[model samples]
Target: MALDRWIALVFVTFCCAYGYLAFATMDQLLPPFMQRNPVWPSTFPKVLAILGVIVGLVVLFGLEKPDSQSEPSATDINYRRLHEYKLGQALMLLGLMALYALSLRPMGFLLSTTVFLMAGSAILGERRWVIMFAVSAVAAGSVWYLVQQVLGIFLRPLPFFLGG
Candidate 1:
């Protein structure tokens, strides 16, 4: 099989896995809203999951099959290289996001988000230290401000290092 086909298959498999997880875990443990509408709880995610499964199946089996013994041209190889770089960056970002999620309650919003943003930028080849730090700080601050002030989510401040 071609490398592109393999990559497509992997992506399709990931979509299927995501859909399965979403389908299996589409419930809120919290009680029905005391003062809000009850119809908004789990509908969106379930709908997205259903769509994901359908798309995954289509992608897995729908694309034109590549020639079995043909080697890709230089340009095709270059494109594949770029594709792999993007895929790697995406996977790292996803991992960092998961870590941030796990650390949200314990480490608080500011710190976890700062780490997530900085790590993701660095991994994606942001070489300027000043830019990375500034971007990370701004990104974290924006999210913190939105959640705490605008949305009233009341995210916890970072530890003393961040000077709540």
Candidate 2:
């Protein structure tokens, strides 16, 4: 009846549903090479579902006792400051996400994701320009490389003009 149990049960149910979706939607036809391979497009997602189910079951059954040390300390801010929710910042981030989604095809994954990361960080109050640019570019490039090159997925990394 505890909150953690509820969360774990929800997690397990979600994982089961996810795994079913992967199985039900799997492609029926593939090139001869790919058809014979053990790793399909859904392999990773199904593996994630399995892992999630295991972790959720462990959490659901492993708890011995609730710890009282989770109580907030003196340095913690009071939760009554709902007026400082920074609604403007949240709205800006949402707008930025919408722009990123719209720009993905034209700007390509690498450029759009890098810009999104930098803009999101700036909107969240990161002041160091060089660090923001470097981190965003590296993270975006790394993900693009992994998804496109390593996983054999197609992702346009450059703008349309650049032959993405």
Candidate 3:
């Protein structure tokens, strides 16, 4: 849909900004010794930003063009549903995301992400406590394992007291 193209464009903008920040700010923060390494701390964020830009570009231009003579088709989204937007929930989610970012290093990936996921789900109206906890734990732990162990990215998966 054309709306998707707009979203992709916005995504591309965000990626470009993030990449620029990684290049301009993050790289300079590393000490000379660490900067000399093949993979500096900024490397991952830059790579991710590049990948995001590529994906956004693909989404932006890969769609079929609508014929000029044809009427609007079912592919178009029903913007009328915009009335269902919940401002309070969105603001709460944004605040939660900010808190998660702040807590990531101090609390470690496993605990921070698990709590974030659980609280996010509850904010979005999930009521099953057991299921929510299980899903949150699995999702966060799996991501932590993949990023830290499999990818060798060195995330702190547990608290400092637990020797993460």
Candidate 4:
């Protein structure tokens, strides 16, 4: 199968699974207030899953084949190679995001987000440590301050040993 087809298949499978889990566990996952809200907690996940499946199906079956005259040229090949490189980078970033999600409660939003930002910048080929750290720290701190202070939103408590 082509890489695009494979990507579509993976997207469909992931979305379906995510949607199912979200639907099945909505009561447990959502706060009581959110569950009682008009929009409903499972709506977004269900919509995302449906859209993902629709897009996947279209990608798999709807695209028109290129004519012989439109065959890939040298420039197209180079662009495709570059795209593949970027795709690999994107996958790595996704893995890092998953790791950050898993670590968030234990590490706290400030620490986990800071690390995630710093590591993500490095993975995307940023070489200057000072600028990277500064940007990451500022972004993380700003988000933390906004969410916790301005918005009065509560985050998961840091581990007991960390003075949460």
How many clashes (backbone N, Cα, C below 3 Å) per candidate? 0, 0, 0, 0
Query: For candidate 4, lDDT tens digit of each residue in 61-105?
Result: 736445565555544334346655568788999999999999998
User: lDDT for model 3, on a 0 to 1 scale?
Assistant: 0.87
Whose lDDT is greatest here?
3
TM-score of 2: 0.54
Give each model's whole-structure lDDT. 0.70, 0.87, 0.87, 0.79
lDDT score of model 2?
0.87
Q: Cα deviation in Å at residue 23, candidate 1? A: 9.1
| Tens digit of per-residue lDDT, candidate 3, span 100-126 | 999988898999999999999999999
CA-RMSD of model 4: 5.3
Q: Show pairs that collide, candidate 4.
A: none
Which residue pairs of candidate 2 clash?
A: none
Output the number of the TM-score-best candidate: 4
Q: After superposition, how far is residue 97 of candidate 4 from its true place, in Å?
A: 3.1
- Assess every candidate by TM-score: 0.56, 0.54, 0.55, 0.62
